[model samples]
Each structure stands twice: as structure tokens, then as C-alpha cells.
Target: MQKIDIRTVDVIQYLQPLREGGSLPAIVKADDGFLYVLKFRGAGQGKMALIAEFMGGELARAIGLKVPELVFMNLDESFSKTQPDEEIQDLLKFSVGLNLGLHFLSSAITFDPLVTTVDGLTASKIVLLDSLISNIDRTDKNTNLLYWNKELWVIDNGASFYFHHNWPNWTEHLTRTFPLIKDHVLLKKADQLTEAAVEIKRLLTEDIIRDIVSSIPEDWLQSESETMSPADMKAAYMEYMTTKLSNIDLLVKEAADAR
Candidate 1:
């Protein structure tokens, strides 16, 4: 299992609002003098989005994928006063505590699968990772990829862990099959799904799976039910991921069948 240490930084300046998805992440300059795509804790999607971003990015990194460095960005209430947009002001005011940040890739262009061709091994690995995490946002409509400095970087995985949204019966859906992967943009290019499956199984060991879920901040694991504490939620996330590891073959076959 690989270890990850999350870096924290103070958001010194709000450069601009991204306003893309429901979360409405913003581009900001941190005290470290780097621009970051900051995902607010007060967004409609709540802290679950941040959990998905951190957990998904870390998993991608562990499997040798290109993902921007993630940081815990601190935003002060005073910072909201500087924004003229009333809506953004309210968002910042509510997200005054801790937020998740993705290192911004300046001038990076959105990847178009039709225009660019990816290698078989890399494509297969990416498909496998998305399946393992149950990421639903990597379809052709939204690639969630950026081409920076001649490399394809994966980004925006807040929609990966949908299971967290319905925690009450999460266990019943643990073995649920992901049939939507047929729409994955890279499915056609991933000719080595079988080989990728072996690699994914080797990389995502039980200990590695637990370590990944444990890295999530306890504060983000807000309980939706009285019986579910933050620690219990974290444990559930671990169990969910580790259990999903055994079902990768189903996902691979689904993608292969789609191809």
C-alpha cells in the first residue's frame, strides 16, 4: 500500500468562479502562489464531493495515473466580502472552513477522445480505475480530462462515489454491477481490459484499499443517520471499495461487451 500526505494551504485570493457543475468550484491563488481549482464544502453536493475528489485522485495516483496534486485549502469568511457576486459571496461565506483544491493546469485544453488517440494499456487502466470507483462522469459527453504539457490528466471525480449518497442500505448495493460503463469514452481504445484487470487487482490490495479510505478527513464523513458515525462511514467506504475489487471482472466484461 502506498502512503499519501495531503498538503494544506490558505486560499489567499479568489481568482474566479468556475461555475461549471453543481459544486461551482473556483480558481484561486493559495498562499503557496499556485492557482487551484477549489471545491467548496458548502456546495449543494456537500463534503461528499471533496471525499470523492481526494479518494479518487489518490487511487488514480496509486495506479500510475496523471492527476493534479490535491490540497486542503482554507477559506476565511472575510474573503467572501471581496466578491461582488452575491451568489458566490453566499457560497464562500458558507464554505468558510476547509475545502478541497486541485492544482490548476494553466492553459490546459479539455481532451477530445475523437481527436486524440490513447495507448491501449493506459486506456485500459483508466477504464478499470473508473469501474473500481464507479465513476459516472467519464462518458463521451464529459471526458473530465485535460491535456497539459503533452500528458492527459484525469480530473473532477466528485461523481464517482455515488453509493455514499444512499448510506442507509449501502451494503445491499455492494455487489451491484456497473452497466453504465458502456458509455465510457475510452472503452473502445482499451483493448487490453483483461491485462488491465490483472494490474488493478494487484495494485488495489486490501490494505491499500483501507489506506485510501482512511486518508479521507473524518470531518468530511458527516453522518446522514444517527447510527452512522464518521468512523463508521469511513469503515463503510473501505469495505465498499475493497469489496468492489473482486467485481472488476464484471465491469471489464461490461466495457468489453460495449466495445
Candidate 2:
């Protein structure tokens, strides 16, 4: 909090009757500047939800996508709402906590999902990205996508990240393969799933991976350790990345053909 950049911000406020159930509270700056969607530590989904949004959203931005602007802040615990999911709420009712700054789209002005933002090709790219990252979110209907500023903004990555280690444990982990690239947008002349695979292949690095893992807040580490154990999750993630890199050619061709 030394030198400032986004100085135009006013006071951050919360809205009522928030749309989503678990994540309702938002850090809304005055005069429609921005809103930060803070993730809470409920019973079922631990801090992994926060990690997924922060890391995945950052990765998407790094890969040249129009993701919602996010900021990592140590906001007051009052900013987030406790889970109403009876099971989760019951378990964590004793240990109320603050939040992990991974704000979502609260703006009403964002683009329409069909008209302005992404199409098949972009979706396919997202699918490829998810597969490589072992992301269990992104579905045809659920948490699939969002459109803003004529470009799609990706969100709801809780199913990925630290949640991977809980794979056998998380009963809701999605296991569907993706569609072909030709069927996707293809971007007319820019359709190059093959090249993209190769590119995605090259982008992987130990540093990038390390940066991702290290970015997760330490307090988010579970006390029980059985849920989303970082070590196990890290190994699984390593294996997942390796497999994706190895099969880059195959996946790209597969996507292209399916399209």
C-alpha cells in the first residue's frame, strides 16, 4: 500500500440481497468505480475457492483475455457472508473468518454472453486451459461464462486449484471432456488450435507454477489438512500439467477435429 495506482476509488460498500448464495458481500467503491467479490471460508469449500479465482483469473489475464479486474486486499471479515449451506455452515459456524480478495462481476453494464463477448473458439481455448489446469468448473450451463466489454470474463474456478487434491473427496467434481475446435468460434482466419496447443505447451514453467502455488494465503491452509492438502494437490497438479504438455499435440488435434 505504498505508492498508489487506482487512486480514484472512494469508500467500499456492500449491497443487499446479493445474487449468489455463498458469495454475496462485495467491496463496492463509491460512484460505480469497482466492486471486489470476497470469498469466504465455509465448511465444504475451504480457501481453495479463493485460490482458484485469484490464480485462474490471473492466468487468464496473462494469456490475453478480458477477465474481471481483481485486487488482493485484507478486507474486514464483515465484508463476506457465512455460508447458508446447512452442512458447511454448521461445521464452520464456530470459526468465522475474513476473506480472500477474488471479486466477481457485480456490474449491470457488462456485455451479453451471446452478442459481444466470446464464441466457440474462445470457449474451446478456455476448455483447453481448464483441461491443462485440471479445472472442474466451466460447464455448458453452470459457471460456464460471463460477457463484459464485448469480451468474455471467466469466473467460478473453485472447482480447480486446491480443490483438485480433494478429487476423490469432492463428489461434485465434473468429469466431462471438451468439444472440438472447429465447432467453436475458430476466429475465422485466426483458428489455430494446433499452434495454440504448442503455445500453451511452451508457456508452462516451474517459476509460473511456483508463483501460482505460493500466491495462496498461508492462513487458508486447512487445520485438518485432509481437505485440500496442498502437498497432495501440488503433486496431482504437477502430474496434470505434465500430461497436458505431453498431450498438447493430441488435444489440439482433437479439439480441431471435433470443431
Candidate 3:
């Protein structure tokens, strides 16, 4: 896999608020004249959520999953003053610097597995990728799958890589199996867990892993704890993910059992 680059885009307009999730991500128009579902760093989740969005979404796209383009959105402080809603204003105020943006799919509809038939191999790949990242947002209740341009597009991976929230104990959780596979929307649809595992392992090379980890902004990695600098935190993430990749067999087995 080639090294992936994270682009930085400036927000030109804040169109409207997407009231779907607790974080209150908004559909904002960027300078590129593209609409993006912007996940604010100032919202309830903070910088950890943005890191997960950057890392998890990239990993999904890296392994052949159809994820929208992920970019670093620049939000200016003045933009928040135009909003009348106190909640949104506070969110923008808090997220005045860098935020995560998901390229908005205008004509896409939510993917409901009951009405659509996803191939076994594709389903298995999605499940395996989600498991590797420990994503908890892709359940039936809110299947993050979007049917757009006649293909399924993965979105909103902010809930993944939750270990970053507790960096001190990230090592302990590195080898743990993702227990949420049982309720995964695609568990029954997937039958090629082993094949998917092989493909994932092959695609996630060491250089690719490093690029993903370093793709995160330096500001996001800042810690009040003097023990772990931003560079150390970045190394920690790379180490943790590479360890998880080696131990993916356990997760594959867990997914198979759930199926």
C-alpha cells in the first residue's frame, strides 16, 4: 500500500447542524467547495475522537473498504459567533482549531442490511476491519454504512480506537478481542473471516501503520502528563496497532464464533 496523506482544508461555511449523534457533527462547506460532515474536537468526545476518526477511517480505506475522504478541517473562532444555538456555538468555540471532516455524500442513504445483500467476502472484510480497530459505532441501530454511488461507503469511525483515551493502560487492551462483534450488523452476512484476515494483515504494512499514526496532528497528541510526549504517544499508537495486527487471529476467531 502507498503512503496516504491527510489533507488540510479550511472551512468556508457552516451550513447546518447534523442532529443525529451526541457530538452534534455539522455539515459544513469547505474552501474546496465540498460539503463535509465535520466532527468537532470541542464536542463531548474531544481530541481522542478526532484521532480515532483519522486513524480508523484511514485503516478502513487502506484495507479496501469504501470510506469517504478524511481530511483535517480548519475551524476559525469567528465562525462560531454566527451560530445562534448555544450548543453549536459552544461546540464551535471549543473546536476552534483542527477538526475531523468526512466528505459528505449528498445522495447516499443509510444502508440497511435487511433490504440489501452484501457479498460474504465484503461483509467479512468490514467486520474484520471494525474488529481490529475496536469500533463500537457500526451496530444495527446505527449502521454507519452509507449506500452511495451504488456502493457501500463506511463513515463515522470516531468511536473506534478507544484505547487512546486511557493511554497508560493501552498496552493491556492491545490483545483483547472486540466483544461487540456479536451485535455487528454484518456478522451473519460475513462468511470469509479467514480470507479477510489475510487481506488485512497483508495490507497493513509497517510503513503504512507509521503513516497512519503520524497522520494525526501534533496538537492532538499533546498531553498534560509529562511522562508521554506527543512523539511518544504517536509511537505508542503505532506500537499498539502493530501488536494488534499480529494478534488479529484472536479477533478473527471471536468473530467466527459470533457468526
Scored by lDDT, model 1 comes in at 0.87
User: Taking the tens digit of each residue's C-alpha lDDT, what string does model 3 give over 1-259?
Assistant: 4789778999999999989888999999999999999999898879988988888888888888999999899999999788899989999999999898999999899999889778888899999888988899899999989998888888888899888887778788877888998999999998999999999998888888898887889998875753678998888888878888998899889999998
Candidate lDDT scores, in order, read: 0.87, 0.51, 0.89
Model 1 weakest 10-residue run by lDDT = 218-227
> Residue 224 in candidate 2 has what lDDT?
72
The estimated TM-scores of all candidates read 0.96, 0.65, 0.97
Question: Which ranges of candidate 2 are over 4 A from the true structure?
Answer: 1-12, 20-34, 73-98, 103-114, 117-121, 161-191, 225-239
**Cα deviation in Å at residue 244, candidate 1?**
0.8
- For residues 112-210, could you state the per-residue lDDT of candidate 2 as single tens digits? 434554454465567567655556555433544566444577765666554354566432322323332333333232355665565565565545655
Tell me the TM-score of model 1.
0.96
lDDT of 1 by residue, 142-201 (tens): 999888998889899988888888788889868987777888888889999999889888
Candidate 1 clashing pairs, residues 3+ apart or interchain: none
Which stretches in model 1 have alpha-carbon errors above 4 Å? 223-226
List the candidates ranked by lDDT, beginning with the highest.
3, 1, 2
- Candidate 3: where is the Cα deviation over 4 Å? 225-227
* Winning model by lDDT: 3
